[model samples]
Target: MRVLTSTLLVEAVTELSRGTRLVRAKEVLAWCDRNQVDCQGAGLKNQALWDADLEEAGGPHRLLKFKSGECKQSRVGWALIAHGAKAREAAAHLGWRELRWTGENWDWLGGEPPPPPRRPASREAPAQAAAVRG
Candidate 1:
């Protein structure tokens, strides 16, 4: 069983159209929520995953189904969101927001948290920096 890595998912998502990408992303969020511990039928033994995820590296879109009564991540050092540590959780931790957005170039999730986008220096701060430099 090949573990569906985020890298693979990202690549798949990149291949999809913006509208379709969001649809898949929404499914991912739903999958995570449904599989949450507090939710019913939430356990490795009872949980089910999408067939596409297991087969085609479905990424985000595609109808989901259980592959029997349980599922497991094929990759080593991997765990499901229900158990703890999931792709969605990792995405959130890396600063992904659930907005109705669709863009091929937009980053859905990054393996690591990215640096904050640069902002123009404020007037006072710029002056202070210049004084120090001079």
Candidate 2:
């Protein structure tokens, strides 16, 4: 059976709109079938897909599933959220706030946590540094 590698996962997510698009359970099943992956009932049996803490190479983001059962029974499917985005953000995006969200699972996609965005230094910093040096 084909394993769900980071590349396939990333491609699937990217092709599906990077989490902005809501994928159905059947579509996910089709992906597995097309890739020659084995499914456990209606869900994938791949460890990489089920592991909540799986680290893989891609971007500074995550690929997660909103699981309601042991499988992909839930209509809500997957999303790719920023690594630093809060659990609530994921929960909200997947519309699981009022549903069975306890088993939400995720994989650590992306290589390094991206460098923090740089902000311009304050106008007074150079003057202060020069005075201190003097």
Candidate 3:
């Protein structure tokens, strides 16, 4: 049980995507497998989760535009990864949590919480960098 984070999701999609090409659901599932994450439950659902902006959901970039008959049965339709919804006012609906599509709805994925965000390595400590700047 590993809690999925937006940062990790972004990294996965970035690594999986080619220039101007969106990552497909299958490729993302493969990534989860290679990374040892728990996402297999998602495949049992009607809609596929994508790593794109939720704002894109109602816009022209909708991933559902490509669904097959098997995918067209759900009201959930599809969901944009939580990370993609984090920057907007509408984000309140998505929240920041360890979520997974459990074939029926979004719920806790149940794993250790994500690690704290890391800072880039610096030649000087923060106080030293500030002292030098001053």
lDDT of each: 0.33, 0.47, 0.40
What TM-score do all the candidates reach, one by one? Answer: 0.21, 0.39, 0.32
Lowest summed lDDT across 10 adjacent residues in model 3 is found at 62-71
Over the full model, what C-alpha lDDT does candidate 1 score relative to the true structure? 0.33
Please provide, for model 2 over 4-85, each residue's C-alpha lDDT reduced to its tens digit, 9 standing for 90 to 100: 6555665565565544454444565577678775434245454455332233322333555443323244443455554324
Off by over 4 Å in 3: 40-134
lDDT of 2 at 8: 62
Q: Which model, 2 or 3, shows the larger TM-score?
A: 2
Clashing pairs in 2: 59-110
Error of 3 at 55 (Å): 11
Of 2 and 3, the candidate ahead on lDDT is 2
